[model samples]
Target: MNYTLHQLEIFRTIAQLQSVTKASEQLFLTQPAVSIQLKNFQDQFNLPLFEVVGRKLYITEFGEEISETAFKILEQVQSIKYKSAIFEGKIAGKLNISIVSTAKYTMPFFLSDFINANETVSLTMNVTNKMAVLRSLENNECDFAMVSTIPKKLKIERIELMKNKLYLIANRDFNSTKKKILLKDLNTNLFIFREPGSATRLAMEQYLIEHRVTIRKKMELTSNEAVKQAIIAGLGISIMPVIGIKNELQNGDLQIIDIKGLPIETNWNLIWLKSKNLSLVAKAFKNHIELKKEAIIQQHFSWFNDSN
Candidate 1:
């Protein structure tokens, strides 16, 4: 602290604005205080830093050189501070998180593991569809979002958490009649789907469109539980994440059809803003989620094999 960091900060601000008065206004100090600091800086340099000609203040050549060096020194000091924080293992903060509706089952269990290890940190959770999660990231509402669909042109940075697959689910009665069915054959049956902008629903629609299959009639539901209820009630069939329907599928309330190219495989990703400053808590949460996501998925959906 030989050369006060505060002095360099004031000098940099003054250099940027090219006006002592404006810097003082922004820093919440009086004009006289800014002037005194500037005079102190000049005294330390043993020279005049600025030449005030007319109403404008212009920096001298020596002042320009000092300004450049000051910025570099300040940046280095900040880098050291950041590195020191990471080494100190100080994990105590709240992290705001939003995830796709289906992630409610898996993400919480994974986060529970983190909570067990770090008793100091707390989590605030939001379960929403992909579009809302993307909106949360854009608006700085959430520190990170867990989603299957990637948004376009949003400047989001995504890390692949794990591979997740979408499956065609039906009531046990439907499975008893036809253990195996064709995609073209299922076109005549009524379809239950998630609402628009849902990544899983979108993927299912894309697959149907690609295969030239159209449903006889369609019903849109808000939650996976609702969709599963509709299917188990023998109302219609729907496509959803395998992880989301594990319990029912295992309990024989619902079953997956062995159809060729029916279930679509996809990756789950954690996304956040590229420009926002990631807090220490947020960074720690992201690292923990990404590093342990795969194992969590496996633990929850161990019955489902990775093989095609």
Candidate 2:
């Protein structure tokens, strides 16, 4: 019956991380301090929030319900703080953003400009896979999420940021001739693929499926950087976002294969839950992105136009 916002925050962090040790590190508190707060939080409810199994923490059904409520409370509190800051005519608050790993190549530039423009604003950016980003948005854990493919099932609003063009990339030495390849020809080569649940992988799979292309030998990598490296090592070819491979493409370490029906084009979308209240800082960022999207693309992604 008696608990503070701080205790609720601790509980939420522990629940999200599923590890008290990690929660402590994220909160900048000692493990014992985090444990004490969590204990106090659970004592107030007189019920177990989580269970430990084989040294791993799992949230119970009741714990999941409570955690959802805790998130709503925290969001409302933040909304109130943002409203106060608005009345004071100051744009300030923490902006939590979740970005799919592939967007890491371009999102940072926009975020840097936003941060530089608003000195009072703080930021927490979580770079993760597409599924994780969607989950973050669904759980109200982040103010915005940037991804290539927008899920049809989630009740969220999205704005197109730019084009996401994925291309088949191979080691420069693989083919010395500047000859375009056919999509059907790709099945013969080993293909390096992004991990399952990745937007890039999903896009690639959809395209291949539609074209009736099946890769018999494939290597799955968890990160774009790893996939690029693996391709450079001649492990296989991969379909990667052009934004993430611009540097390598320019350096001639990797070459975008001129393939018939290549460069799967998708839009980069900025998404947020429709029901969640946006903080002042979050609103500012949304505006900033809209206003500066074209200029940002021109500055950092001009190559896109030239390549296309």
Candidate 3:
């Protein structure tokens, strides 16, 4: 009660941006106003929260701790607001979601429908690699994370949203005489791989190790799109999610190689830290996914069901 929320908000912004000028712009206040509020906030603590060095701002250890606490407090406050709104028979709040890059193929369509149906709800989506999404879930930075491969080390609750299939893909021009290639045949072919920390890459590697199949040469690409482009350009063949290559496959730009025991099957899981309390919005989104998951798959990815 000693410090106002406005002061904490200003401080948090400054800490995050590391620039008074940028914070002021973000907060839609004058630079002098931001400086005055920051000074007053620091005065309440009776210590320097951040230090200026070489024309750049750096948060002190104490500042970092305070900033983290401020975020938790703000998050709780938002949850309280959401709870109150729900009690009044209104569904409205912000939803923070982190998704692995592979989920980008289908997540947006589902999210779009959710957002459209709930006009008052605000949503933030962070698309990144699997490891980063897991870290965000562990840090309680996001309400939910969508991933293909769940890590055993993290104690989290997960629900299978949909099935993901990884397929071997090559350029249309690549000639192969066999209808069904043996896994060992890939030993002589160059392969394009996803970068480290990618769930797709991990799955592919595990399958190869299990079958004792080894690729002759490999190139690592950072993103699914980049890997797809590399394959299209004849850089090398890659194992990619079927969802990611829908357009390319439809256009005849890429062809799926029918390797025996290919098309690694995995489930797309929606995960959250078991210890974190779920806000109303988070619970609503989870429920929404559970209720509409099958419909979503059938609509956007019907081919998957038909083929299976």
Whole-model lDDT, candidate 2?
0.87
| Reference-based lDDT, each prediction | 0.81, 0.87, 0.86
Candidate 1's error at 281, in angstroms? 0.7
lDDT of 3 by residue, 167-274 (tens): 889999887788878787777778888888999999888878888887789899999999999888988888889888888988999999988767899899888988
Query: lDDT at 249 for candidate 3?
Result: 88
Query: For model 2, what is the alpha-carbon lDDT of residue 304?
Result: 80
- Return the TM-score for candidate 1, rounded to 2 decimals: 0.67
How well is each residue in 1-308 modelled by candidate 2, as lDDT tens digits? Answer: 98999998999998899999999999999999999999889888867899999999999989989988899999898878767766778897899999999889878988888898776687899999999999999988999999988888899888798888988889988763747677677778898888888998998888789888888898899999999999988998988888888778888999878877778988889999999899878888899988998899899888786787
Name the better of 2 and 3 by lDDT. 2
Report lDDT (Cα) of residue 274, candidate 2: 93
**CA RMSD of each candidate after superposition:** 14.5, 6.0, 5.6
Worst 10 residues of 2 by lDDT: 175-184
